[model samples]
Target chain A: MKKIISVLLAAAMAFALAACGGAQSSAPASSAPAASSAAPGQSSSVAAYATSLDDIKVKGELVIGLDDTFAPMGFRDENGDLVGFDIDLATAVCEVLGVKPVFQPIDWDAKELELSTGKIDCIWNGMSITPEREQSMSLSNAYLNNKIIIMTNKGVTIASKDDLANYNLGTQADSSALEVVKGDPIYDSIKDKLTEYKTYDQVIMDMQAGRIDAMIVDEVLGQYKNTQLGNVFEVAPVDFGEDLYAIGLRKSDTELTDAINAAMKTCIDSGTAAEISTKWFGSDIMVK
Target chain B: MNLSYIATLMPALMQGLAQTLKLFALTLIFSLPLGLVFTLGSISRVPPLRWVSRIYIWIFRGTPLMLQLFFIYYGLPFMGLTFDRFPAAVLTFVLNYAAYFAEIYRAGIQSIDRGQHEAAKTLGFTPWQTMRYIIIPQTVSRVIPPVCNETITLVKDTALVTAIGVGELLKAAQGAVNRDVNITAYAVAALIYLAITFVMTMAYERLERYFSRHQKKEG
Candidate 1:
């Protein structure tokens, strides 16, 4: 009887601990800034530029939103904490601006709400700058140039974009590739024939097992997956469209835009961006 | 905040609610029998059959449902199997919950007395007949509460299916939160879940009363 009671108690304790562990796992974002600041010269003089970017500088922090599952760009680590290339970039940008960075994991499709209501001061993921998106948000200069490539099973015979015409292409719904396929003139004939999924991971699985002909995804991601999948998949260099990675700021905050552009330039000159890109992507894919 | 936004979204949410209901309804229809088959296999006199059923139960019950969901939706296609989002979500849920329900059914069936089986045998009934007419009726009564509890859990567990992108209630709520950045939308979503759960609880109570009605009469 005592043994049975103890076994039940152990099971109950294990369950309680699991529940607590799951609940405490928050998205790993940079911690909020201290209520005070270090003395002058301890860090770069952010005060000189404070009057220019006063709205966010006065707030003493920038809330940056991203979908943390995108790798070589942004993703959660084993600890369930958000960490990746975009995370490193955001940290560096915040350090230069002398503001704290708070990370919020926003669904990719809902970035508009994450920005407009000030839940995040900016969108700093591998956000592609497009003509339509320019109408809604202010953007910095193109920080990196990327194009969508065809990731396919090695034995499948896709060599170029035209070779993929009749085949069903898999891409995440609402992603740049999906958008281009739906709206752009290039893919019009084949748009209706495509299968868009919620996650490209699902599509990649299909491609691996020959369920689909190819997956349309960013070139960098395609490279990462090719390396991970070993020789099972082949990446076609032929691309559907040029996707430029840029920082998205609210249209109302031109000062923040100018500030971020300056930081981008500094990071480029200092080789910080290239170093971070190498750390994650294993090569410097940074735009000059 | 506007009536029009609510008006537009209410229809969409309702459409999603229908899918949620379909997934919920079909999972019960399929898994209930599947659970019984599993129960029988697990309790069978044959060692290999019993062992296979035990391992199936152990694996499904031991892993995180989210990991199981991802493995099915993402990992399965690598092995050359592809299921549509709705079917994939439903299949995973049924397979997962069936394993859990099997254990509950087995416990209830095993709880019946050895004398009951012998009594049925003395009355010239075959072994299968004894199990069908004698063992199953009582087991049904014993397992109803646990089965209902699982169904309620299934309703919530269905939300994890969003990883495969079925656009169920919680995903809709996420869409709302992504656009607004307020907790009110999340709160409203929680209320929707609460409403579903409450209705199920009441229905389960009615079922328990209906089944135990015979016991009350005998008393």
Candidate 2:
């Protein structure tokens, strides 16, 4: 009887495990389309917006959404206070526009949703200006020149894009670096070997473990993290493409977009942008 | 509603489901036996063994699995112990689930009547024999239901692997959603989760029936 019970329990556990496994493997095929059919209209409702420059002036504060973990651009400092290049730039821009800057840390993935829903007046982190973004929201003229660069372990020899085919690369998911890698035709052959991480920090961790051979990241971020880590990694010569950083707002907010553009130009002409850049990057790398 | 759009997403989601299944299977395979060990240790008469088991269960069950994953994957490397993405995820899940399973095993084992042990001893069975042949066998039928619950929960919990960026089903769906600017992929992911749970429910029902057959005949 005892033998029967033990066998029964083992069998039952196996069966239960297999049950979930089988279900998961088979579920999406029959039900996914049905569920997705009802999603388009519901999600569309989340995209409507009406905030403008007048609204911001009357409100007397600009709520700027950013991923606070993004170093140098917008991240927490040693004292746990929010400070970064973009944070300073946004504060100065707010000053010119006669409003206070209220930094709102947000999930980087949902920045677009946060802006569309008015949870934030603008996304002012190291936000890259892509064509898709240009269609989705009002974007300021590019204020910072960024490029996708590959960073490999110091000992690894990556001379160019061709050398990357032999390596397992990683990049932050939903990031411009990932987009650039995916968009590059040269990566077509080895794209299968690439991994996407939630953050550059994770990619760096994986790189340290030798689990990944290289990571594609922005020059600004790559330089900042490498410097902070005492230059444990080296940059590869492969260039993906130019990525320009800009402020993102609701598409209807053209007036606010123009206002921010003017404010940005004022900051650059007054050398405030250069000062903030030098403070963070050790040199003025702003797009004047 | 777009058939072609979903069709395009199917391949990506399926790839993610494969990773999810692998994580679930590996977690169950390792955690179940380890959980049994912890249970035995918890019930042991040895003072240190019992305390160690108790503390292990307390820490694992008390904390969130997500934080545990972060600590193991990202935190431990600072102390010079780094794990690859998949291993880190599996290690965290196995350790966390083992604690919960240990408690369930402990309850099931303790519920067995003392008379059963005495009866086995009267038959010249050693203490180990009594547990192996008499106590554990009965405990199995009793713990199957809860163990089944945990197994199903593991399926959904595999989604948490996305935090460290090991693209499982939900993450794949999320990626599709972000890329396409549509929430339809999320809806599909939900349906996929529900379908898996439904199948798990049916499988458990069959197992329950099989386990209770003898009791039914006696009743």
The fnat scores of all predictions, in order, read 0.00, 0.00
| Predicted candidate 2 versus true structure: per-residue lDDT over A189-284, tens digit per residue | 878889988767778778978999899999998887787678889888767888889998877788889999999999999999999988988889
* Tens digits of per-residue lDDT for model 1, B1-219: 565545444544565567778899999999899988999998887755776677678667987786666556544543456576678788888899889999999999999999999999899999889889889988887899999989998988877766554657666555443332223445666778899999999998998898888788999
Query: Each candidate's interface RMSD, rounded to one decimal?
Result: 17.6, 17.8
Each candidate's root-mean-square deviation in Å?
Answer: 21.4, 18.4
The clash count for each model shown is: 1, 1
For model 1, what is the error of residue B98's alpha carbon versus the real structure, in angstroms, after optimal superposition?
27
Candidate 2 TM-score over all chains jointly:
0.52
Per-residue lDDT tens digits for candidate 2, residues B82-182, read 68778989999999999999999999999999998889889999988988988887788788899999898899999987655466887667655433435
- Against the native complex, each candidate's DockQ, computed on alpha carbons, is 0.02, 0.03
Residue-level lDDT of model 1, residues A63-158, one tens digit each, is: 787775576577644333557788998888788888888876655654653454344678898987766556666788888878877777666667
